[model samples]
Target: MVDWAAYTLVFVAGLITALATGIGALPFFFVPDISEKFNVGLWGVASGIMMAASIFGLIPEGLNAGPWTTVAVGLVAGGLLVLVANDLLMDADIDSRTYEEADFKKLVLILGVLTVHSFPEGIAIGVSFAELNLGSGIPLLGFTVPALAIAMTIAISIHNIPEGVAISIPLRTMGVAEWKMVWWSIFSSLPQPLGAVIAFGFVQLAEPLLPAGFGFAAGAMIYLVLSEFIPDALEAGEELDGKGYRELVAGFAAGGGAMVLLLVVV
Candidate 1:
């Protein structure tokens, strides 16, 4: 009874997002360094895409599938999970710098941190595809892909590019090779496929929970955009006169517009 084929498609979608992180490191092969302003803009762009996807894509989908109350509960639960994970890992924080001298235990700790950060994104992709083979959707390559699924996959892929850049910066400064930088960036998000498959399976089995799944993914992403993404952009943009708010806003508009355009086309 298991739709292994559909699951395979979902995993592939998640894998695509994870691989997208590598794109960030490709520029390093040609340039000595990326501008801080550009990095800030990337973060802003990521935040904008995530926020738009959550608010316009996920939340509405959740409402359409089930009651608003259930969706609210899911939102809270999703936000809480992120908050608690951060709190738990607050002291366990390790960075690219930590790896050079890290032991096996330390390496495991680093991976755990990366997994926590990237897992929700995978979940969002999975939740978006909950109706993958169950209902009417865009047909492609013999699969009924939800429009939201395509949108989330694209959104998450774009979002991960900045994350890849962030991961690569420290490695680049550490004299790591460009190819290794790309590899490490991809590794940071490697847990995505697992998260995607698990979430997709859960929603497909428990149909009633579909809406909550949508809300959970949306809530976690939106919270991350606010609490982490925007602040990061601001921090990186400090040298920009009058702050990098302008660049940040511009990036946001562009990212959001891209999502809107994709949705319209799909």
Candidate 2:
């Protein structure tokens, strides 16, 4: 009994996050110049939001659904998934320029790298919707949407904005058109809908694995925040005062605190 309607709704929710990435690129449309200080802050903000979502939303939810051991296993497995993917693609570096200019074979390679980047967010969206319409939640359109699902979706969508800014930075350096920057930002996240559908279908069938699923998504997401986002922020802030540590911390506190508040509400 595949609930096509639910699947469609979830996919659309995921797509909304993907589209939100485009919003990051929108600032370039208005101004040809954006300060590096602002860029560092943007990365810091995105990292904070991601870290908070994983810590507050995903892990606790996993614990509530099942034993800590199951969540631990999922977390370890998720980290390993990222580790292995990075190891495989260690020599292959893809950047915004590569995104715009890559031909067929090159395109395939970059997409593989991006899978490691984006799929976990999709999984997060999917697992949050595990209960879907079966439990009490907010009604939207015609379906009873889970509150966690809505929270996770918004969290990811907001995080994607700064991520879009990061992506647009290099493209801006190359003078890529504003619309193309937005398109490429969205393109990077296109797999999310499929990832969401797959995770949703899997959890729906194996209800027992819900905790592990939550752990898996949380683990991957947090790993990314640590390994990728934080480092990127630091690298961007290398020339800034205090090496941008103050800005990073400030952004982290703001982003995490905001998500915590949202979690409290929903």
Candidate 3:
């Protein structure tokens, strides 16, 4: 028997994290020009929060589960899933020119790509809720919530800011209304709640697999930070400043250090 209430709460948490990305789009509403420096900084913050959450929250939870082999396998599987999705999307010849210029088919393609991009984030949120009243000791909404749930929620929300900005930049150029940008950004992340519910259900059904769930989320996120987010930040910064590499390195170090400190303290 599944605990419906716990699943609902986890879904809500994931939804809230997804919605927080909308906040990043809000800046475009007032500020016509968003500085490149600001974008880099936002990425830095996102990276920091994600790393902190993965290390302090997800990995630790995974360790609580049985053998290391389970976690290792889950991590590799999660990363491979993202890679496969990326390959499929990249192979498709979807135009990335303009949102308005894109036909319905192109829009669908874009959404598909976005889904691959966002799924792991949703999974992280979902897996974090594994301990929902099952054992862990944090309390929320009349149930004993896992601390990892709270941490993942906060981490994902912070990480989404840069993503929202990335989405808004294109929409802005396409002359999409600011509010519409916010809506679309939120729309891009809509899968999170569904992911959360599914993951929570899985954990509830297979309690023993909870640790693997944690490792899956953590591995996916850490891989993203290393492979995609950091590289994107550096490239973006390079285009803006001749010494972009320096800035990228500084930002990465600072972000990673901050996350480490947070983990240590919290």
Candidate 4:
């Protein structure tokens, strides 16, 4: 029989990451405007955390679970999916940067496009929990919690805060309520739970494809950092003297350091 308890725990873990996005909008509740430097830093922080998570967390686990060839195939496939999705979004004239201003229909379209990116993050969370309750994990709340699962959950949650801020900026300018900003930010990541369940189910059933799962998530996130996150930071900081590259680097270093610290602890 399938362990519903384990499934529920995993789902909850994924949900936690989704909810953490709301924390980003909490600043808007108090402040009228966030500084551009801070915004750029947030993006840089996200980039750093994601890069570390993929290189140190996901890829290593994938290699341990399966061969490097399997991981490589998954990496290529993951990046390719993002590339195709980006083209589709461009052709559709759906600019994710300005999605907060979208109407209902456009919002739906944006969410659909966002799934391509968010799904991999969810998958990363799910794949990390592949060893849950497998008799070789830390005991927690009546379950054997995999250390990797905890680490990924924390990493993704932290990574998502900046995304929430990004989503909220346009909304804040449009005079959207702070509460709504939080809701919209969470909405952007709503697909995570579903993605988590699907990936977890696949890995649990097939067992052999776990490495591919890791690679796919890692590849997708790394591609997004390069293609979207960094550019967004640069664009936002364009008015500054050095295009905010220094802030980005500083944020990246901080984020990377944080994740590395977590890795060491776990």
Candidate 5:
């Protein structure tokens, strides 16, 4: 019963969300060096935005699709998927060191590892496009555009800034050119658009599963933040002699609080 055209439009919206991550990297081309402190702040802002999107956007949407049981199952499945991926891709030896000394093969390995974390973000963007039209009668590019789509796109784009900085850090240490750093950062996030499109298409085809889709994306993202983002922040902050840990905690709280405020106001 789903309209293919509408579905395709949603998929395209997802693709745009993913591609926006690439835009975050473009800044590195112009800046001589991005400070670590600045990167940390960026990450904090990204963390806040994503948490807000998940809480305000994804969870409520999921609950609308079905009973609590459905959302619960999707959440568990999403978290499990990430856990399996982490176990499979993450090796302490490889992750313990920075990417500077890594050879070409090692770089590929790092990319693979990073993909596990980034793919969920793309999925979140894709899932948010499910309500592309809601009740709107207006058409956009032959399909109705949902307010949720615009919000998700903006949220995902904002989230990518910190991720771009994270990608650039290793490249900077490797003495990669500024522009190249931007390229690589963007390259790492290419999967986002692809993931978004696929997610949007899937949700359209299986409309009844929309709630599960939302939960799945939310679960993956929330788990990633708790498992990956927080830990990484802590590790990066370790150089600050205890001050880093404080900053990490403070940043997390600030980011989460900001998202809460945004949800209230917008």
Candidate 6:
């Protein structure tokens, strides 16, 4: 009973978002350099969007689908995964920000480690599309795409822009070409399409795990924001003389507001 067409569509949606990450690097083509304060602010916005998507979109949907305990467990497990990934990355001396410095093997190793974070985001997108064509939902490409699916896709795509910038920043500093920066940014999220397809398949096969899946995605994203995004932003803006905090707050507000607006309109 699998709808291969819908599955392909979902995968494409995820892939599009992943590709959107490359667009973040486009700014560097026009500007000689972007300010550190703005970069930190962008991270703040990404953090806010991820947190909002997790809290407002993912968790509530999860609760509606299954038991509280299931969601709680998934949340904790997702957070722990991020924590462990961070430890591993630190030990390996392979943060995404410094990808240019890594040798080929280390580059591959870091990308593999990043999948721990990116794959869950893909899962979140895939799982959101579970109800495609089953009931009343937004119309897209001859299918009844769920509103949540659309929202999640947009949220994740927007959140990814800052990530692309983060990756591009270091490469830019290393004197890499603008085009290469774009390629590297897209490469960072390349796992998303595979993750989306796999998650979609799993959920379709075992409907009961849907709620836990939501929790897992939500937890991973929120934890990533708190543990990685904010800290990185602070570090980037360290020399900004208290402007970092202000930018963080402003960016958070803008991101959250934009997400809420998207949800409301959609």
User: In terms of lDDT, which candidate is strongest?
Assistant: 4
- Per-residue CA lDDT of model 5 for 1-266, tens digit only, reads 86777656655655565555556567666667545554454455445555666777667867876787887887787777767766655443454343433333334443443454455556666676666667774466756667666776777666565556555544554556777766676677777767676677676555556667667767766776677666655655666756466666566667667666655654
Output the TM-score of candidate 3.
0.61
* lDDT of candidate 6 over 4-99, digit per residue (tens): 898899889899888988997898898676588877777777677667767887788679878989989888977887777656655674445633
- Residues 7-36 of candidate 2 have per-residue lDDT tens digits of 999999899988987898898898866576
Candidate 3 lDDT at 183 equals 89
Better of 5 and 6 by lDDT: 6
The TM-scores of all predictions, comma-separated, are 0.64, 0.66, 0.61, 0.69, 0.63, 0.68
Q: What is the per-residue lDDT of model 4 for residues 1-266, given as tens digits with 9 covering 90 to 100?
A: 99888788888988998998889789888886658898788778777877887788778867987899998888887788677766665556444563342333334433343445566678777878888888688899998889989988887787677557655654554566899889988888877877778778887653567678678767876887787778878988999879999999999998778777766665
Off-target runs (Cα >4 Å) in candidate 3 are: 1-14, 24-31, 95-181, 184-192, 195-204, 239-242, 257-266
* Candidate 5 lDDT: 0.61
How many angstroms is residue 41 displaced in model 2 relative to the true structure, after the best TM-score fit?
Answer: 1.8
Question: Please, what are the lDDT tens digits per residue for candidate 3 over residues 70-169?
Answer: 8787777657655665566556666656543333333343344344446556766777777667886777779987787898798778766655765665
Q: What C-alpha lDDT do the candidate models reach, one value each?
A: 0.73, 0.73, 0.67, 0.74, 0.61, 0.73
lDDT preference between candidates 1 and 3, better one: 1
54-99 per-residue lDDT for model 1 (tens digits)? 7877688679878999989878877876666556555554564544
- Listed per model in order, the count of residue pairs whose N, CA or C atoms clash below 3 Å is 0, 0, 0, 0, 1, 0
What TM-score number comes out for model 4?
A: 0.69
Runs in model 4 deviating more than 4 A are: 1-14, 24-28, 93-177, 188-206
Q: How does candidate 1 score on lDDT?
A: 0.73
Distance (Å) between predicted and true CA of 123, model 6?
4.8
Which candidate, 4 or 6, would have the higher lDDT against the true structure? 4
Q: Alpha-carbon error at 5 in model 3, in Å?
A: 7.3
Report clash pairs, candidate 2.
none
Q: Looking at candidate 4, what is the lDDT of residue 172?
A: 58
